[model samples]
Target: MIKNRDIVCIANTTWFGEYTKSTVQLMSRLAKNNRVLFVEYPFTWKDTLTTFLGKQKAPVSRMLGLKSRLELINTENGSKVYNLVPPPVLPVDFIKKDQLFKPFFNLNVALYKIALRKVMKKMEVKDPIVITAYNPFYGLPLIGQLNEALNVYYCYDGIGTRRHGKRIYAIDEAFSKNVDAIVTTSDYINDDKKKFNPKSYVVKNGVDFDTFYADAKNKVHKNEQKIVGYIGSLDHRFDINTVEFAVKNMPDTLYHFTGNLRNQEIKQRLDKFDNVEFFGSVKPNDVPALLATYDVGIIPYLVNDINKNIYPLKINEYMAVGVPVVMTPFADLKDFSGMVSVAENNETFVKTLITELEKDSRSAINKRIEFAKSNSWDIKAEEFGEILNKLLENGND
Candidate 1:
């Protein structure tokens, strides 16, 4: 019901044809009623220069394709995606010296401020609700300059736990305290944010049920061969040892991983298993068809502080296609006990996969589909809208 308002979302992800994450999903849905400007993370001169010189032809092409330093692309929904080119800034991760870093960081902020002013003027954006995800360094500087009606810090990950996160934790903490509202994807993140902002709320991730559920009835793989699939980024969070054990234990089952492999060492480690197949990144539209071919979906995440807080969207995506999920122990998995088979370790995870594959029935599929329908992106967007409405109604008092 929050309609006709201008909403400016500063996100870590790019809007130019990539895997849709929570920010993109929410903004897309919100666009049905509101005017949205999705500002992608600014590209530094180094990034542009590197992309120009890099062997990756696609990125170089995309960079060259930019019509303007700030190009606006109109979406099917009532939203505009603005891609910004940032001035050269010190790479915060590599630069350890404060004396050298602060000057460049300040210059980066000043340059962005000018760029943002131009974007606002071009779009005729005024008194907009500013929603920022991940990059607090960018958001912190723009806090008072924009004349934003409300400032929302959307925390999707335990960013402070990561290697490069230590440098920005203090900035994030300050941003959280100053923001009008803090929205988090998990309870752990929400609890942490509440220490700084009492207005923090947990709005967990959801799936795009329409696209996913449409293919739920399509049982393309009628073969007797069982396919155990894992989708999403194959990064450090992925439990390679658990997957190795599971694949080794179940020689008959075909293990398929569909995603961009961030950790080459892990992929190399798992390559020895002939049963394990790696299908490098598939388009988001092609996911449900891939899910339809899956006998069971596995979330073999390494249990750690970072992984524990993650409410995996793949779990919902798998369930949306009526595929039973076998996941490693995570705090948020407790809510999904009925739909997902939670496993403590490699032994239980493998056992659960076998059990789910053996007992895959119409009744179970229906149950999962029904549960997924209730947690669609539409529903989550409505819940998020309600919170935003309350904030606007109260004038962020």
Candidate 2:
């Protein structure tokens, strides 16, 4: 493990948020041997306004200067993550032209640097290894300014998602080349990322086994209605058509969802089904038990540009709890072909789901549990640490 080192992560998510993401899970594990700092999402003026208006949930007092922006967060692994909230930035997305938006972009980066530098100096963080987690716009500009040992572009997703707009591809390419290493969560993403940086590596996502494993053993499925659950952010990524087909075909089965519903149209359409139930986002600690109730877990994603390179987190969470897994063939599943069943189209998806419902044996469950145990966060974090060590050893900076 990389011990006694200062690790700074410039990430797109909150330290304590609705979901327990890969960044949070890995960073929390890494913090056991290193001083980790989680730089939260760069909030825009619009985000601040929404938070103020109670339309969004955020660190309101910290954003408003009522409370400190930087604090030490105690993690479950008995390590602390220094979470820092940078100043609110300009919401320049309204300006379509690059020439018009460049000034505001520079201004936001400038303001962000001041906030980050202040916190780093106060905490006496020196020779830190910086990991820019999916914010390539700011990641590109903040390159040589942080007085860091190395910068790892942690590209969990491809560019052009979320706030990474039209110019993200070029910006992402530039940032990838400049960084010491590019770490990805899937081989599909790695194929593109490694074209820019040779140091690119795929440290696939994993589960917190102790929690989910216990959930598998402890929680018994009590419902008479055969439950088919999906646990992830309900967005455009989720295939409503695939879900609708299954719901209509299998009227006896209960369809459950547990994640923040982003696409309202999905809710409007899927809610009309009497069998479908939506359990909105839950605490990270509570997820294992909730997933344990599922007879079968699914990744019903539309095979779009984003889903083509995607690796949903729920796969491991589901398997860890001995739940039979089924999914639409969105990304690479060469590693999991033995354990997870994939269907190419909606009709076949329903068919595969029914087959899963019909035949789930103790051997299959044991195999999945073993797979989950092998791909635990404990193992993934160590794999990541090895990559960090290799980067530092090579003197990539």
Instruction: Using lDDT, give the best candidate's number.
Output: 2
lDDT per residue as tens, model 2, 1-397 = 7788999999988888777689999999999999999999878878888987989977777865689999888988788888898878889867779998899889999998999998999999999999999878888899988999999998787665366567777888899999989999999899998888888899998988998998784333556888999887998788888888889999999999888999998889889889999988898889998888888999988887887777778898899999988998888868787889999988898899889877877777788898999999989999999999988988974
Query: Among these predicted structures, which one has the highest TM-score?
Result: 2
What's the count of clashing pairs in each model shown?
A: 0, 0
RMSD of each: 2.3, 1.5
Q: To one decimal, what is the Cα RMSD in angstroms of model 2 from the true structure?
A: 1.5
Candidate 2's C-alpha runs over 4 A off are 217-222
lDDT of model number 1: 0.80
Error of 1 at 144 (Å): 0.9
TM-score, one value per model: 0.93, 0.96
Q: State the lDDT at 160 in candidate 2.
A: 59
